[model samples]
Target: MNIRKTVARVAGVGAVATAALGLFSTGAANADTFIPLPGGEITQTLSDGTVVTIKLVGESANISGSMGATPVHRNAWVSASAQVQISGDTSATGGKIFPGYVVGCQVTIDGGNVNGGASGGVSWDNSGNATPSASANSGANLTLGPGQAKSFYVLDQEVPDDYGNESHKTRNKFTGNSGSVTWSDETIGLNGCAGYAQARSFVSVEVETDNVISWVTLWGQPFSLG
Candidate 1:
């Protein structure tokens, strides 16, 4: 149960004005919280040495908490934009996947597959339940081991745009291990706890598959940090 904490610079104001420049903490690139304000934005070079840009925007509406004297601090604006290149679980068994900040995602796999069938596939329930018989392709049953890797393009998967059951919003409650194809221009929403940025507030997730699951069961919102 590891939790990655997000820190605020609040830029001494003087440093930004005097030094003419300030840098955010260069830490793990896993699904982290990188909030830039007033004309601020975050750029990162991942473990693969690829550069990424993150945008943040404040809410237009002021939220009054409890309708009382204390006003809820405006949640800073944050948006992570990057090509979702995924891989690294083609071989490991009964493991987990994680958002290691900048290391991409560590996917988990198991020997489970379409119940009582040949060609052996991955399953979401290693407990010996059968997947929907209509499924066409198998889940992520591969890994890159401790060194190999792969990549994928990311775009938004909004429920409104979803033509099927694979939408991010629909999958949010599914307990089975799996991954999402984040569309370009998709809004991660706030708190990193749900919607698209769930991993943000999670710290880290633990992924495991022994009997039926093929993908992973995250451990922390940002596993490495968690």
Candidate 2:
């Protein structure tokens, strides 16, 4: 059997298998099967009764690999989106910074029988900033098994950026704007490395007001890579 084709086939099957096993079930009747990410909505209430909501609409991935020589290389392109809204009684006099939304993907690699592991992810934040920023992180010196398996992160709704930068501070005490924030077709890429790869998307929020710096993951899905 062609290792490349076989690996690719397994990657496709992995997405379906994950969904069939209820791993991708988000209690949404209209959940998508082709995308390897979570499909649904989430809502959270802040200390001041501010309601933060997020939703994952859809996601997709493209993955390929080459094993012609030693130290194979695999690359992937992942994309996803979400809808974010903040309403209810928001603070108007407190020094609170609301980071509205974040979109990105995570990858995990498991080399079958080789006892090897590597992981990484990339994401962008639309945290009330005019110009959003993107970032990525991964392990070093990765090695995979003969038939390793990888996972993709399709949608994670609640992720925080590295720091509570001024640009990411979407809402402040002065402008207690309560409305909708949407990120569409946001994309990130991963290159090099080998073994099986999987990816998914995520949405998140970082509240840096009242000494509360917390992040929450609202939605997520998984896909396969070569």
lDDT of each: 0.20, 0.32
Q: Give candidate 1's TM-score.
A: 0.21
What TM-score against the true fold does each predicted structure earn?
0.21, 0.42
How would you encode candidate 1's per-residue C-alpha lDDT over 1-226 as one tens digit per residue?
Answer: 2222121211000000000001111121223344322322333232332222222222111111111111111121222221111223322122221211111122221222212222212122433222212222211111122222221111112454345555331122213222221111122111111111111210011222222222221211221111
Stretches of model 1 off by over 4 angstroms after superposition:
1-70, 82-199, 202-226
Give the candidate number with the greatest TM-score.
Answer: 2
- Alpha-carbon shift of residue 164 in model 2 (angstroms): 19
RMSD of 2: 15.0
